[model samples]
Target chain A: MIEAHSISFRYHEAWVLQEVSFRVEKGEFVGVIGPNGSGKTTLLKLLYGLLAPQRGEILFELVPMKKMDRRDIAKRIAVVAQETQLLFPFSVLETVLMGRSPYLGRLLFESEKDLEIARKAMEWTKILPFSERPVEELSGGERKRVFIARALAQEPEVILLDEPTANLDIEHQIDFLDLILTLNRERGLTIVMASHDMNIASEFCDRLILLQEGRIYQMGTPEEVVTKENIESVYGCEVWIDQHPVSGMPRISLLRKGGR
Target chain B: MKIITLKKVLTISILLGFVLIVIILISITMGSVKVPPLRSIRILFRAILGLKGAGNETERTIILSLRLPRAILAGFVGAGLSVSGATFQALLRNPLADPYILGVSSGAAVGAIIAILLGLGVSSFGLPLVSFLGALLSIVVVFYCGRQEGRIHPHTLLLAGVIVGSFLSALIMFFISLSQKEELRTIIFWLMGDFSFSNARSILIIFPYILLGVFLLYLRARHLNLILSGEESAVQLGVDVERLKLVSYLSASLITAASVSVCGLIGFVGLIIPHSVRLIFGPDHRLLIPASALIGASFLVACDTFARTLLAPVELPVGVVTAAFGGPFFIYLLRTRKAIRTL
Candidate 1:
């Protein structure tokens, strides 16, 4: 479990995140939903200790993140960030093996155990067939799976994802979310995913946190947070809300100003 | 598709090591007085084993005193510059980054010029020591200027290097304008890079710095590979990005300084050797770093051989020879292969 006690962060004069506080329980699949510039990415970064909060603190299992070394923090939390550029020609296996860096000693290379773990992760993500291919040659969806496999290789208690499905098509998006959901259920993994897709978040997440202007606007079940009024108020857009046909979860659809 | 295992790295190292030894022997044999390859090998073995009376005295002197030291010096300079170039490319995330990209060479040139103007004998340690200090000073200034919010921004660091390099180059030009006629030739030759003045002492002086720098960089090979993914990703993967940047910058700078101090500014070896190595081997730093060191040594020794022998009584600057050969070969590689673009 992770806890944030009124954490705030800023770069220069603008506060990117302010007075934000939340806790994620073990094996929880939480989705953070927001419009553009709503500090969703910053929140994920804070949770993983990539950027320390300017005020207050984040704790992992009741221990303040500030006290943890980067390697220690990495062992417990993995992040699949948006826009990881493959500038070099690293193989899919090689990229995934990087997740074991926290466990590797300074002078030691990756052991056979480490390779086995990486291969197993690749198998779970269904990228084992292309383990020898270069990452730069993979499609966007395949690359996302590669990243997820890398995150799995870390064997972390929690995984943070930022806009994981942004550029992915609908099928790939659903496929990605389903894979993550399976991991949460079968492996007892914790997930905190930041996304702008309301319907996807509503369909998949157990709970949702809606953010606006660097503050949490609402936090509850999808039915409680995905209402039309809340969307209009925060996003300044008219919208229609209903239940998903299959899952019976709250679903959101955009409406034109004078058409609906 | 190819991941570099330790066994693969050792194999490639042995192959390249043999290549380097072959180049050194060939270089020793092909100089002004042509000692046969067998004789050169025997003389080198005798010198290494500290044996005597197996070869002619003059041939022994040529192999041990003059040509041997020069070839060794070229090797160190080649290895140092190429390793530094590879490190800089990784640190800056730019394939074009060379050993001189950070203005270290220009700073060293300024130091060497100052020593020459003061009439410091080239045979003394004063010139190289001063140049090394000058290089260190430039690294500090560039690092200071490149930091943003206590982290090194690659773009800013690169810009700072360019600005500092140009400024120091201007100072060099000013010094050249004010120098006496004889001093001008000395300064110009040093700036263009020369190995004619190399001896046993110069080789010994630069060996420790190059070895230390290369070893430090090799230890961080995995971290450097992680960093090529992007700084934020590297941090999330448990790499202390700032500390890695600092260490890489300092280590690479140390090697560049040591090389420039001894042999002036050898161009193209640093710029081209890493790319060639990366093309032949994959971009894994463990293999790339050592491979670059060995291949670079051979390339430079070969170039220096051509520099001294092509015109025989009239010597060309080793820098000129490196650029002359390296530029065309690099262009050919770029045109013929798509792999360099991945860099």
Candidate 2:
């Protein structure tokens, strides 16, 4: 389990996250949803050890994250940054192989075993044929999959994805989420994903953490946390919440001015 | 894969052979005391191979001492600059960055000029001493000021280098304006760049420093490769990122300063040779660094031949020849490379 205790952070003079706390367990898919500038990314960054908390500490298993070495932390947690802007033309295989960096020896070439692992990861993500192609030449959805392969190659226990579905098409987004769901249920991987799509989060995530202006408004299962009043009050939008008859999960739809 | 590697080796070897032949042919036949290529080789064989009664003394001395040392110096300087340039380009992740952009060249120029003006307290190797000092000081300044938090911000370093380089450049101009007319001519010639000044002693003293730099850079090949992913990635990859960046900046500056101290700035080999090689050879520094050295060496030999013989007896500074040819070629390569990369 990964736990954050009453985390607070102040950037320069302004506070960003204040008294936030949550837990992510093994095999659980927790979705964090918030508006822009609502500190969703900030919280994810803290979880990834990219930023330090001002008031509290985080624990991985039983060890405090601060006490763990970065490389050690990296061995267990993989992060897919929000913007995957690759400035140089690294080949797809080369980019994914970089995930194995923390495990290789200095001045040593990637061994056959390591290459095999990278190949397996690419195959898993279906980016194998593009191994020799420059990542700069790949399309948006392909690049995202390639990045996911890179993260998977790390073979980390916890995967923190910062808006993995952002900028993707509707079909691609669903496909990506389905892949994540498979990973969680089949492999027992702990997933912490942030998304702006409420319906997708409701259908996909095992639990939801609602953040509003840097504070946690609510944290519970989708049915318990996402409600008509909470959506209308927090998001300032009228929403109709009802059970999905098939999945038995809460589903919400924005009520337009005249109809829902 | 094996075939490609073999092909790359064969290609590089052929290019190297071409460079060596060009350097030999042009060095012997194009100097002030010129000789025919046949007699030049004969003379060079007599002196270098120590074959008695093979050639006359004048031809032998001209080939062995004067033109030959000068040619070898050009080759070494060309190769050294390009290698360092390649290293810096890899480190900074910016195609435009070179040892000069770190204020090393300006610093060396300022030092050489000051030594010329103040006389450096000793006549022996005064110019080099001053230039080395200048280069060293600028590197320290750039490394310290160029760094922030834990990483060297490429833009900030570039900006600092520009600021410092301009100040030093202005000072060099100021000194150039103040010196006697005769001294001024020598300074201008030095700045213009010529390989005709090196001797046995100067070469030996400077040789070890440049070779040491090349060795260190070669050793850090993998570390340099890791840096392209950004420092955070480099660190995650088990590299001591800060240390490697510091090493790269210092080592490249060392070779740049040493070469500029002996020969004036020969511009394009550093910027273009590595870039072109990378296009054909890929961005793997292990391959690019060594390949660039050979390509650069041969390139300078050809360029120097042109500098000496294009106008004959009245030698043009190698720098002028390089810029003249390199400027347009660089523009063409850069524009095309950018256009191709976007696709």
Candidate 3:
């Protein structure tokens, strides 16, 4: 579980996150939904210890994040950001093996145990077939899967993903989300994912945290949080909300200005 | 499944080591007077084993006094520059980065030129010391200039290096304008890169620096691999990115300074050799660094040998030979590779 108290982050004299506080319970699938510039990515980075909150502290498992060593934090938290521009050629396997870096000692190569873990991670992500191919040669969806495999190779207890399906096609979006959902359901992996797609978030997350202009607008189950008024107020857009006939979860349909 | 296994890479490295030994023997035997490769090998072996009468007195004298030290010095310089090149390229996350590209060499050159202007003897350890300071200063300047918000940008770093390099070159010219004809000739020859003045002491002076630098860089190969993935990703993977950058920059600059002090700025070896090794062996620094060092040593020894022998009595600067040979080889590489990948 992770707890952030009164967290605020400023970039270039502008506060991207202000007085934001939240808690994520162990093994919970949480989705952070926000419009553009709503500090979703910044919050995830702060939680992962990549950025320190200006006025708040983040705690992981009752310990202040500041007290934890980087390697220690890395062992427990894995992050996948929007696709990184790899200027160098690394094979898919190499990229995934980097996930084990926190576990290896200095001057040590990948031991049999490390390789085995990486192999299992690759298998979980279904990226084992292209393990020898250069990451640069992979499609965007495949590369995203590669990154997920890398995060899984860390064997971290918590996974933080920033827009993991941003550029993915519909099929790959469903595929990628299914993979994350399977990890959360079967492996009990805690996931804190930032996403712009409300339907996907509503469908997958056990709970939703809606962010508006650097503050949490609402936090609850999708039915409680994804109400029509809440969506319009946070996003400044009108929306219609109804229950999914299949899963009984809240579904949102936007009201475009032409129709409105 | 691994495309390039550790075992295969190790075997190739060992094979290259043998090839390097053979090249060293061939290089020592080559000059205005040709000594056979077998005779050269015997002389070297006997000398190493402390046995006598492997060759006549003249052959022994040539092998020991003229060729051996020079060959060793060339080997060190080549290996040092090449490994340093690999380090800079990885640290900067740009394939185009090398010591010369980063202006570290030019900075050291300024120090050497200043020492020569002050009439410091070429053999004096002061030359190497000053050069080391100069190289360190240049990297500091470039590093500072390139950094924005605690991160180094590849574009800014490359631009800063070019700017610093040109500034130092101008300073060198200003001093050249103030020098007498004899000093000018010496400075020009040094700038073009020469090993004619190499001796046993120079070899000893440069060896440890290269060895230490290469070993440290090789040890950080995994860190370098992570770094090339991008700083944020590297940090996420638990690497202390800033510390890795600082250590690699220092080690690389130290070796560049040592090599530059002993033999003036040799261009292209640093740029060409490592990139070539990367193309063949992939960008895994564990293999890339050592392979670059071995291949660089062989390449420079051969180039220096040709420099000494091609015109018979008139020796060309080895830098010229490298630029001539390396430039073409690099172009060929660019044309041949389907795509350039960063690892």
Candidate 4:
């Protein structure tokens, strides 16, 4: 449903993404994996229209991204960025209702229908109980859920996320991945997420794209792309690749260079 | 915006409106010449409705000619300052942002002081016009100096604003030092802010600009609420972030220019009222904007009343009173709300 065609982006003089192109079919769950500074976040931002590429184009279903109205694009594509800081104390409900803004008219307030949608999104994310609580007071994990709920409230066909579980604990990470997988399965939602967790990416995503030095190194199923050689070459880390005992998905284990 | 239930928002707005009416009545009643509150309210209503009343003509003259216009101008100034303050805080995403903080007041002060030196005093329409021009120029400078890659960096903007503000203050001081004794006293009094010069014509001049600016801002309250989620998120949510920012900046600066044009740099009404309102009511611009307007109007009316009557024959500058009250309140807020940081 989304395509990045020969997209190149740079900040000042340093090129962060160079001629990087990819495609995601409808209802596909794709994960972008890369080492630090490999442009994982940059690629996601370019795809979501936060940055205009220097070289090429992004298309949503066939329309050029630049041609589409921002509101129209927003209705179809929601983004859950990394951690957001708010100076004022907005309640969780208020933050979620802001997701409905794209759907609202200039002078119109949120209708009862909008409220119902927001509440349902909150309920699905299990944050309905914290609706009245200030969002600033929430934990990192809970805040991630609130952001996910906000994305759901956008009712978009595709969701883009940048490092959704970067700072999370293992338990929260599993819960977060589980929630995302459930959304993809139940709603047939197309999700493209940038993640640093190779294991989570291998276990959860239908396809993975490994990026190295602002270029796409490989794109395929996890078993096809996440080989020992690929990991070593891209990340400069020696690792052993094995299949998970229960899920039969590829798993990676780090190796010491000279000894144990 | 819907953080509070609709019922609660309605009740609070209605209550604020009532308080505003009571404040206006009391403000017009207490002045150099005392008038009963009931009589003052009756005179105001009769005057507004164009009905003849049996009250003494002196009371009517005092209420209609002097006190009423001063009270109304004070309310307008208060409302304009507070709404613009709220808008700036949201636009810049900094709680410390106000017209004064952004160098807009200093710019306007420079223009007004120049007008005073040139002998174009409060009665001249040119003073407000020049002040508005000066304010617009300062914003342009701030935006130019602070922008990077089409976005205004918060830290750079704040630093540029402070630099510009102090530079303008120095210029104002130079002009003040060059003026004669009478001009110096007049400039200082005007800088401190006094409602005594207010008349019906000044109200007529300020009314439309403030109304238009406030209306435009109120219409964008939802957009501003979305912006509170941070710029990139707001854009992803279809806020048209750049356009919204431009509109908000222009509208807010426009109103600030208007208020500073009429009342020379009333310091704390802009800074304190909106911050206090946000602490009480959650940061939903829909409620925050109008609530700030109402509370600001009433608060200024009360302050102006106190300013005029506190020393009997010698009136304190309304700015002095507001600063005296606002400075400590701001400190209290900063101390109590530990979440407030340099951003």
Candidate 5:
């Protein structure tokens, strides 16, 4: 559970986030969607306490974010960033084991239980076989899965991801979403993700937060907020919105705007 | 540090062991005086088993007086440089990172150069003391310039390191130009790296700082591993990324400064040794860091031995010997291992 109140952020003269506020309920899967430079990442950073708001405060489970140590915050939340460029060539297992660092004591090595947790996390993420291979050698999809395993290793109640599916292939994308959806339902983890793929967010998210120029433009069920008129108004585009035949979720298609 | 099942414990141990033996033998056999190979071996065996021996008083003199301390100094220098290089590479997460890349070497160089200019070498250990002071000042200066919002931005730190290092090097060169020609020769040899005067005093002088640095780094081995995942992820993993960074820069620079003050400039042991260890063993800092220390000490001991004996009576500077081998060997590695997968 987390909340942001009237957060405003500016970089130099440019405003990145303006008076943004939102609450993520426990066990909620909230998908944040917007075009590039819509302040999605800035909001995420603010929520994670990586940045302090220029205007307002972020509360993590009712505590002022600034009051908690970064390590203490890590025990409750895990983040999987878009890219992991480690110049030190670590093996996949080594990467996953790092997830246990938050819970480890100073000077204490990873214990049997810690290693077991890492192993289980790797198994669930299906990267157990590549345990000893360097992370840099991983395919994009495999590396993504490895990072997901690392987050899972944290055993956090809330997992925040910045574009878990951006570079994935369609097949891997389906696989990734299914895995995340499984984690949400079975583990009851809170999932907050920012994605550019509106269709995936519409299909997978329980609720969607649509952002436009650093402010919350719309927030509702996919069917309630993904109307063609709402989308065109926010995204400046025309689209065909229809139901997915199998999942019965709203699936959108772009119909070129102001056709020549 | 979790010892992964795939951890090659035996291989690392074997490599360390093999290097130790070679280094010991090399150090004893070669020095300013060319004792017969057999006599050197005899002296080595006696020293190891604590056996008493006779007439080799001069040989005994060479063993205790000249070779042993120099060998120890060489090992310490190697270990320090290698570990420093490994730490820098991890902190920067750049393959090109080395101990000197942060300007610690140039800072120390400038410090030592100023000592020479001020004629501080007249004191038995004044040069090392002044050089250490110089190094500390450079780190303080670099620290001030590198800080932003209570943290060092990696890019800004790297760039500032280069700028500061070059500036200090320029100052060192300026002083070298103004020095009397006789002092210049001595300064030049010292800059090229030598262990000719290494003794218990020099070792004892810098030991606390070097060991302190090594200790500080050792405690954060796991944190450094996480840092390579990028600072943001490192923070998410519970490392005090900002605080730890300052510690990293300060501790690393302290060791670099101290070691350089006492031993002068050694080349490439830092870059080549760490990368080589990484290539053989994966980049787990737990393994890589200790491995860097052990292997680095042995590597430098061997090189220092080679430098002393390669031309006999007139010894080559250890820096020249190390650089000669390290530079060409590095290029060879690049050519042969160019396509070696990093992922």
Candidate 6:
């Protein structure tokens, strides 16, 4: 489990995240939902220790993240950020093997055991067939899977994802969420995902944290947070909310002003 | 994605090592005076093994004293520059990065030109020392200028390097314009990269710097591979990204300084050899670094050979030969190879 206490982060004079505090419990899928520039991505980065909070602290299993070595932090928490530009044409296998880097020494190459773990991760992500292909040649969805496999290869207790399905088609988006859901259920991997899609988050996430302008607007079950009143107040938009017929979760639909 | 095992790396190294040795032998045999390959190899082994024999004195002298040292110096310089190039490319995550991209070569050139103008003997260590100090100074200034919020930003570093390099190059041009006829020729020859003046002592001086730099880089090869993914990801993967950048930058600059001090600016070996190696081998720095060193050594030795022998009595600068040969060949590879297009 991870805990944040009054953590704030600023990029110059503007605070990207202000007085934000939350907890991610073990084996839970927590979706962080917000509009553009709501500090979702910044919060995920702060959670993984990529950027330190300007005030307060983050703790992993009751230990302050500041006290943990980067390698130690990496071993417990993995992140699949938005697709990074691939500078080198590293093969799929090579890219996946990089996840084992936290466990490796400066001079050490991946051992047979590390390779085995990576292989299993690739298999779990259903990307084993293209293991020899360079990552640059993969489609966006396939590359996302490759990154998930890479994060899985870390064998972390928690995985942080930043708008992972933003570029995918609906089919691939559902497929990606399903993969993550399976990991949370089967492997007991705690997930803290940042997403813009409200319906998808409602159906998949155990709980939702709604952020508005660098502060948590609401944090509760999807039914409690994804109401029509909350959406209009925070997003300043007209919206209709209803239950998803299949899963019976809260569903949101945008409404034009004076139209619907 | 075949696993890069120790055995595979060693096998490739040995194969390239053989190629390097064969190229060195061929280079030694070639010159205005042609020594046969067999006799050159014999003279080389005898000299290396410290064995005395009734060999032809002129042939022995040419192979042992002049051509041999020049070829070895070329090999070291080639290896150093290419390895530095590969390291810089990885650190910056830009395929266009080469060893001289950081302004180290220009700084060294300015130092060497100043030493030449001051009448410092080429044979003395003072010239090389001053050149290395200049290179070191440029590195410090560039790094200082490139820092953002206590971290070195790649774009800022690159921009700083260009600015510093341009400033130093202007200084070099100013010095060149002010020099007299004899000093001008020496300055021009040095700028064009001459290996004719190389002796055993010069080779000895640069050998350790190049070796240490390359060895330190090789040790960081795995970390470099992780870095190619991106700095943020590298940090998440537990790499000390800042430390890696600092170490690689300094090591690559150290070798570049050592090489430019002894042989002046050799140009394309650093830029082309790493690309060629990456095209043949994969982008994995573990193999890329050593393979580039070997191929670069052979390429430079061969280029230096052509510089000395192509016109017979009239010698061309090794830089001219490298650029002329390397440019066309790299273009050919770029045109024909699909993999190279990705870079």
Candidate achieving higher DockQ, 4 or 6: 6
Q: How close is each model in CA RMSD to the real structure?
A: 1.9, 3.8, 2.6, 2.9, 2.9, 1.7
- Docking quality class, candidate 2: acceptable
State how far residue B187 of model 3 sits from its true place (Å): 2.4
TM-score (C-alpha) between model 4 and the true structure: 0.94
> What tier of docking accuracy does candidate 1 attain?
medium
> Considering only chain A, what is the TM-score of each predicted structure?
0.98, 0.95, 0.97, 0.97, 0.96, 0.98
The model with the greater TM-score, 1 or 5, is 1
TM-score of chain A of 3: 0.97
Q: Model 6: which residue pairs collide? A: none
Candidate 1 lDDT at B119 equals 88
Q: Per-residue error at B228 for model 4, in Å?
A: 1.3
Per residue, candidate 2 scores C-alpha lDDT tens digits across B37-154 of 7888777666666667356777777778777777777777888898899988887778887668788998888887787677652235777777888988988887778888877777
Candidate 6 on A117-192: residue-level lDDT in tens?
9999999999999998889999999999999999999999999999988989989998899999999999899999
Candidate 4 residue lDDT tens string, B203-289:
888889889999999889989988876888888888888878877877887788878877787888988999988877768888898
Per-candidate TM-scores read: 0.97, 0.86, 0.94, 0.94, 0.93, 0.97
User: How do these models rank on TM-score, best leading?
Assistant: 6, 1, 4, 3, 5, 2
Candidate 4 CAPRI-style tier: medium
**Clashes per candidate (backbone, < 3 Å):** 0, 0, 4, 0, 2, 0
Error of 3 at B167 (Å): 2.4
Question: What does the lDDT read for residue A165 in candidate 1?
Answer: 92
| lDDT for each residue of candidate 6 in B69-107, tens digit (9 for 90 to 100) | 898899999999999999999988888899999899899
Across B107-164, the per-residue lDDT of candidate 5 in tens digits comes to: 7777777777777762359788887887787777777888887779988888888898
Error of 3 at B192 (Å): 2.5
Best by DockQ: 6
* Residue B71 accuracy (lDDT) in model 1: 92
